[model samples]
Target: MRDGTDHGDQMSDVKKGLLPGQLIWLWLTGVVIALDQITKHMVVARFDLYERLEVMPFFNLTLAYNPGAAFSFLADAGGWQRWFFTAIALGASVVILIWLARLTAAEKLQGVALALILGGALGNFYDRLVLGHVVDFLDFYWGNSHFPAFNIADTAITIGAGLILLDMFLGAGNGAEKKEARKKHD
Candidate 1:
């Protein structure tokens, strides 16, 4: 019942594949990585290792390093945490890449989140491998309460994490995706 043109069209669609169209998300990842690295590089060039510049009443740009995990956890453990954190980030990067490969382009929520997390992971990984620590420059504080300094990579990672949570709770990314998944279960 199909003509030669119809068959050709079908073949073309099949040949287009799933991963090629997903390159946009990869480019988004590249942009995040570039911004994170550029901002950190500018901060390092302008500020001393521990110098702080008050950017506003509630914010400050400070040059600090975290040799450990978030909020300086285990930051004083000498040097072992460096390798430990590095390994974790690398493992996460691999997992995100695998997830992205499997995800469809229509899954924008998860796609964007995965891309952002990928960029953040690579940005921090670069810092860990080269500088032996992650850079921290964005500092926030209240009248007397202060928050730990974090970097652009940390910011992206946080946003990505939030998006992932939103997607999971809202059944977003693709409505039909959830429906099909539920149907498979039933």
Candidate 2:
């Protein structure tokens, strides 16, 4: 006994409170948050602001702070950026959680990507909320040019973004295209 209506009902139930979909990936989010905080705390404890310890020819552990977005985009914007960025992170986190809960089982890659981004957003959100700035310690550079110092949260966010791009090209998008082709044939 099968009915087409049952699938729609199941989807509605999942969308409602009756089912928790793909939230299994939340453990990854927690792990990313924990690691991000721990590393930031360690950098704060071991290094003075602007102090640098050479770890390699092109890499160093440098204590730095950013009160702005990536690359210190608004580091000197008269301090409103902190609250603004924090608000964005909070909103993004909420949206990511809802998106995670609504994901289908087949969207495992998307689930992981969203979880990493959520974790990174919250990790930085904690800093902006409590410290008013993010602690950055990992630095890379060439002979005279130094890249912006960043942290575990930034790294996770970057990797998550890359995964999202990869999925767009190789994952569900392709499956949808295949499904569309099948529909055309039928």
Candidate 3:
């Protein structure tokens, strides 16, 4: 109804793969994956492992491989962690897809957030499945202290997580307002 369309029409579009439902947000997911993979490929071709090209006072285009989770967690835990993370990413992608498909049209923010997270997860999952590690290139540092290197996928995931938190807080406020309005009506 947001666009003068009914839920039946939305469902028809979904069935036709026209991407008119909340699944329309999957277009963002595809864009993120394409950008993430393209950038990672460019970095891999242009730099050697651990190579750093300073771009600014606090940023660099560096080449890094992470065999573990965020911040290189379990990076040194032999080789099993690679598959473990891959499996998790695969499972999460499936769950996100289903969740995105089930979202009401009103849940636009949540849909976008889930799509971003799904795209990021699949992008990293591809690297883990094929390369045994995730390629990370963007680096940020302050003087001698450097943050962990990450890639476009990580950026998307982080942004998506922030959006979800925002939606949660906003939804809470709206719910409270609705409750107050109901009390006044009663």
Decoy 2 TM-score against native:
0.83
Candidate 3 collision pairs: none
Tens digit of per-residue lDDT, candidate 3, span 1-186: 788868785455345432476557888999999999999999999999999998999999999999999999999999999999999999998778756665666677888898899899999999999999999999999999999999999999999999999999888858766556435522
CA-lDDT, candidates in order: 0.83, 0.84, 0.87
* Candidate 2, position 95, lDDT: 75
Model 2 agreement with the true structure over 35-134: per-residue lDDT tens digits: 9999999999999999999999999999999999999999999999999999999999877876666666666787789889989999999999999999
Q: Against the true structure, what is each candidate's TM-score? A: 0.83, 0.83, 0.84
Question: What lDDT is reached at residue 58 by model 2?
Answer: 99
Rank by TM-score (best first): 3, 2, 1
Total backbone clashes of candidate 3, pairs 3 or more residues apart or in separate chains:
0
Q: Which 10 consecutive positions of candidate 3 have the poorest summed lDDT? A: 10-19
For each predicted model, how many residue pairs clash, with residues at least 3 apart or on different chains? 0, 0, 0
Q: Judged by TM-score relative to the true structure, which candidate is superior, 1 or 3?
A: 3
Q: Residue 92 of model 2: what lDDT?
A: 91
